[model samples]
Target: MANRPKKLPKALQKLSKPRVDHIPGLVIAAPASNSGKTVVTLGILRALANGDIAIAAAKAGPDYIDPAFQHAASRRRCINLDPWAMTQDAIRDLARWHIGASAGALPDGQSDGQSDGRFVLCEGVMGLFDGAAGGGGSSADLAAMMDWPVVLVVDVRGQAASAAAIIQGFANFRPDVRIAGVILNRVGSPRHRDMIMEACARAVPDIPIIGAVMRSNDLALPERHLGLVQAGEHPELEVFLERAGAIMARDIDLDALLGLVRTQGTDHGRVAGTNGNDGTNDTDGDHGRDHLPEAGSQVQDQAVAPKDDGAAVSRYVERFAQNNANYAAPVTIAPLGQHIAVARDDAFAFCYPHLIAGWQAAGAKISLFSPLANEAPPQGCDAVYLPGGYPELHGAVLAAADCFLDGLRDAARRNLPVYGECGGYMVLGDCLVDGDGISHKMAGLLPLETSFHQRRLHLGYRLVDIRQQCPLGNVGAVLRGHEFHYASTIRADGEGWLNARTADNRDLGPCGLQKGSVFGSFFHLIC
Candidate 1:
């Protein structure tokens, strides 16, 4: 008999209301990566939020942090719309749900219904035209699909006329995508702004100039090894956003900007599935294609597959879709009857907020457990979760923490679900390789060994096929997730237990390994 079909989550089943017609909005796009699009977009969101404007935020790609900042600026939860990660149906549903006209008084300071119309602010990823490796999945693709106007955010630090050429190329490169206006970011002075604005007017006369933000070293966000510091870690993030918004309000043309944006029409239906029809059902039939592998397929099947860089790009696109769809109908896990201690100190703080919410929704009580200050998992907790974070930075302190190590050993002995990711995965190994080619003794829960000395950036979205039964779910089940880590573990002297691979079939060795009650891997589960 064939395997049973997986049921769609409750969140995905409900049909959303139709979108409101003529809803004003604009998406902020840039010429390339690191163009300061996020800063400018967030500043606008904050400034508008201070008024009577009922603004909604949407991200054009699969980013976790920027959306958090958008959420802060808009005083609402931001939604993601990625052309690659999700089906068109999901994106339409999200747009319809949030794209309604405002009726009540402003939550900020403006009188109710002053800026009564609804507006969405979408922040673009990377470059506007730079799609994924496959060349089709991009922020521009999303703009064309939604028919939303695009506001170009240009960083005019070095060149003036050259910047105009880049903007003109983007405006003309895609005839369908409308470049509604421009936001000059990081301008040096009034003269620099004037030069850029004049050049842009001459080159792309159709696209209006909205704002020009001057250069400011104060706007720079803190960064770590991976990217911008996670928003959760930065408590002063609100203040930073307010400062950026004030600067933008002082420098940019706020009212002229509002005039340039064209409201989008209502009509939230999806462009039928790949079959090219107009319906909500998935034509591909198979859902969670990114997660589970076909049954009876060995790891060797993936070993010989052609290297399609497009697969990586598609995974990135799919992330946006998945995020939006999941939000429409959030997965509610079984409740935690007993308290589950989670490690959440600076050394182990890389857990996704959704995962914790999932656990709590499922009825599991959450109690934060700190190992950094020599604190152990709380007594009577049923399970312990050690998420990925900067364990390498505090290797010596962790190596010397007897209480934390012993507590983990006790939990393992008691047969509790002890799950870990990237940094946490390293802690569960027999030994961890430090920066100076030295190995530090860890919990030794798993038979794996990891090294941080020889670093490599292994980053991408993933689909995990459950080869064996563990705590997360049943055997043969698939899980949506992502992998980003610098350490490489060598199986020094134990049986390998976990197996993983990228969406395009590259080797991702020993991701979800389990030994008794302890299970760990470098992969971060998003669902």
Candidate 2:
């Protein structure tokens, strides 16, 4: 971290400076999944931003999707703070840096100058107490480590006064983790809200009711198999956010909630053990992966391809550009090459921001291309990285993307370092079967075939020991990552790449394959 650049690139200058000693922040968590925490988090972020409060958003664990929506709501880059995959120092460093980069001297790093007055709003993954099978990485873990208060978003759809039991359980779950407040979501009626409010007063009177969100089908975001069909794919996303913000601002006590934020503390960072796991296999399933960069005109020229709907493509490109503008200040990791072409777009969008920013910090130039747009890896890139995304949904489109497929094959022929993960890995294989049971020809760089139709949930935290020299690192270099995808391998050939295991130290034997310079697996790296 000492080698990290003192100044961020010109592109990142837009983030307002943060208060070094006191940037107010809180962790917005819930009792369980579908408690409407994402909606509530987005609403609060948008509402606060609307009221002229500069906001910084973060997601707990290794999720890459929700942060994109969080960024959209806050009009800022949203970073993932993973308790499981990163060290305690790494977690605190990332959080401090993200609160505002210009704030001076963090515990582990230094930034120059004044405060931007940004309030960080971090959304929790799944349930608050949920973490990996070994028990470490959870929203509660993050809240405790940061010494910040948690605002529980409890879904009160079916029960009213009984919601007090759920609130009391979470409040007393961990002594170190404080449940400062609660937001009752999906309230049925005035009576419903009042009943829950009265019960909480008699039970957990120390904890206050932050808000009671009225039930509304309109507030719900659309979802497909993976989760909410990505914030990027949503039509009228801005309208949705605007409406949600207005509702939250009207219903919630923003000032009271703000009071719960730990505004003035430098010693809040307390050390915990480095090893953590994202709670449960289903935790990753709910949160999704790959928060994309803010889209901007910089990508339009090279990233967007010719589609049948020209006007639609233009709008999509413009929206995509909004999220692609800034890259985070780098945290160090070894660069694969001097220049790397990374795949992005709806098809291959699971690349981590830290990985990209780290590459840039390590002095590697990154060029992005869209396989969904029929684009190839940019010329002159010494290496290519294909990240995980929803390739199965667009199998036919990718099969028809001749330029993209041909360019990938050409890169492999040149013996360039080419790596893929999950969806990207599926594309590099000989063939892929979509959910409709239609098999399409792929890049054919690896002697493998996969099927999204014949799905099987292959998930959980992975401790990969690379058995061969590849893009990640030297042989025997251990990496902590995770595998969360439904694409089953139909056929696989070639030598094994990684000797992997679960978080609890169970052997998974050989994972993924390597042939020449091209290799991939379903594993997604996180650090």
Off by over 4 Å in 2: 1-24, 102-117, 262-332
Q: Give the TM-score of candidate 2.
A: 0.81
- Please report the candidate that would top lDDT against the real structure: 2
Listed per model in order, the count of residue pairs whose N, CA or C atoms clash below 3 Å is: 17, 18
Superposition error at 162 for model 1 (Å): 3.4
Weakest lDDT window of 10 consecutive positions for candidate 1: 268-277
Candidate 2, residues 25-77, lDDT tens digits: the string is 67999999889999999998888777766556889987878887887887767
Clashes of 1: 17
Estimate TM-scores for all models: 0.69, 0.81
* Per-residue accuracy of model 1 over 264-318 as CA lDDT, tens digit each: 2222112110111123322122221121122222112111012221232223222
